[model samples]
Target: MSSRKSILEAIKAIPREEKPLPDLPDFGISGELEEGFTQSILGNKGEVLEKSVFENWLATQDFSKILSLTESYRNLSTIELPKDPHELSTLDLAILEGQFGVAENGAIWLDDSQLFLRAIPFITEHLVIVLDRKNLVPTLHQAYQRIGDAHSGFGLFVAGPSKTADIEQSLVIGAHGAKSLRVVWK
Candidate 1:
């Protein structure tokens, strides 16, 4: 046998063991989930918009290249989602649907199905997420429980706009991704 085939056969001969998953602690706190979620997002330098206010705000903006995946804002979307991920890099704004929000960290769950193109959120200049107010959870433990068996291959928890303090400890927003993130709660 060739060296590569022998190496593969040797690797396959090794015994495999199955380990039990660790038990996650319950950190569920009782309070207003929306309030906690809003506070956490603010701490991360993100903006929260009420649905009523967002309507008026949306009408005033002039975006050249926009993509909307949410049903509520489909009328406002300028272009269809392109097949190529590379095409998303030039998007000025991308509006997407979020599965749920975690109050403890202000993170929102997004799966591949919701994102027509995975790069739409990160590559755009600005990103907008529409989430139902009732979908807010108290902690990550609860969030993970809620997301169990729901994701399709890929999922992510997006908190706020991209920021980096790698250079001289000075914070820079939009350093690696979207410069602004606006979460509209309905």
Candidate 2:
């Protein structure tokens, strides 16, 4: 037998060990869940608005270019989306629908099923995500359980606006992505 074949046979002779998966810890929550979620979002420097007040909030915006992928706001785009992704660099705002929100850390889940282009959220100057209150979960462990094997292609959890800190620890917000993120929920 060849050296590679001999090595493979030798490896197959070794015993294998199986280990049980560790249980996720329960991080006890205090007070109302929405309150905790709101606080987390605030700590991440993101804004939150109720679904009832979303239209009123929309009236206060001065953005000239906008795109809305949500069915509720299907006709809300001011400019037609360009065919080329590179042309979207100047997009002022992009409105999307998140599948769910995590209460513990103010993160919302987005997947390719909803995004027209994967870069729309990251390239836009501002972003608006609409999530339902009923879809909120208390922890990431539960979040993972809910998303198990469902999103096979692409998905992400966006906590807040793009932020980064350099070696000196000076924080930079919107350095490479959306300058602002607003969560409109029901």
Candidate 3:
């Protein structure tokens, strides 16, 4: 046999033992999930907007391109979703709905359901996520439990705008992704 095939066969011949998965411990966090969530968001360099004030503030801006996929702002969808994700390179703003938010880290969950195009959130200059006030969880443990058995092609927890300090240990936001993030709730 060839060296590559022999190597593969030898690897497969190694004996293995089965191991039971460890049980998930119950160590859920307590306190006001909303308050903790807000603090977490601030630490991640993201902001939460009050519904009343957001409406007025949103109307004042003039973004070149805008896309809204949230239920409340569905009427604002302007761009025709393109077949190629690269076509969104110039996207200015993207408003999407987050299924839920994690209080422990201010991470918001989105999948194919909310992110119609995988690149929409990443390519947009500014990202706005709409979440239900009641959907905040105290911790990621609960968040994972809540997502169990759910199915989707793409899923992720977006915490804040893309940031990097690799260049020279200096913080830079939107170096490769959304420049800002704002979460709005009804």
lDDT pick, better of 2 and 3 = 3
The local lDDT score (0 to 100) that residue 46 gets in candidate 3 is 91
Write the residue-wise lDDT of candidate 2 on 1-186 in tens digits: 999999999999999998999976897447777887888889899999887687788888888889888887768898776778788888998999999988899988899887868888899999999888888888888888899989457888998999999748989889878988899985
lDDT of 1 by residue, 31-96 (tens): 788989989888888889998788888779888898999999898788888889887777998899
User: What TM-score would each prediction reach against the true structure?
Assistant: 0.84, 0.89, 0.84
- Runs off by more than 4 Å, candidate 1: 1-26
Stretches of candidate 2 exceeding 4 Å from the true structure: none
Predictions: Cα RMSD each = 3.7, 1.9, 2.8
- Candidate 3 lDDT over 60-148, as tens digits, reads 98887888888798777778778898988888889999999998899999999988889888899999999898999887888888999
Clashing pairs in 3: none
Q: Model 3: residues >4 Å from true position, as ranges?
A: 1-27
| Candidate order (lDDT) | 1, 3, 2
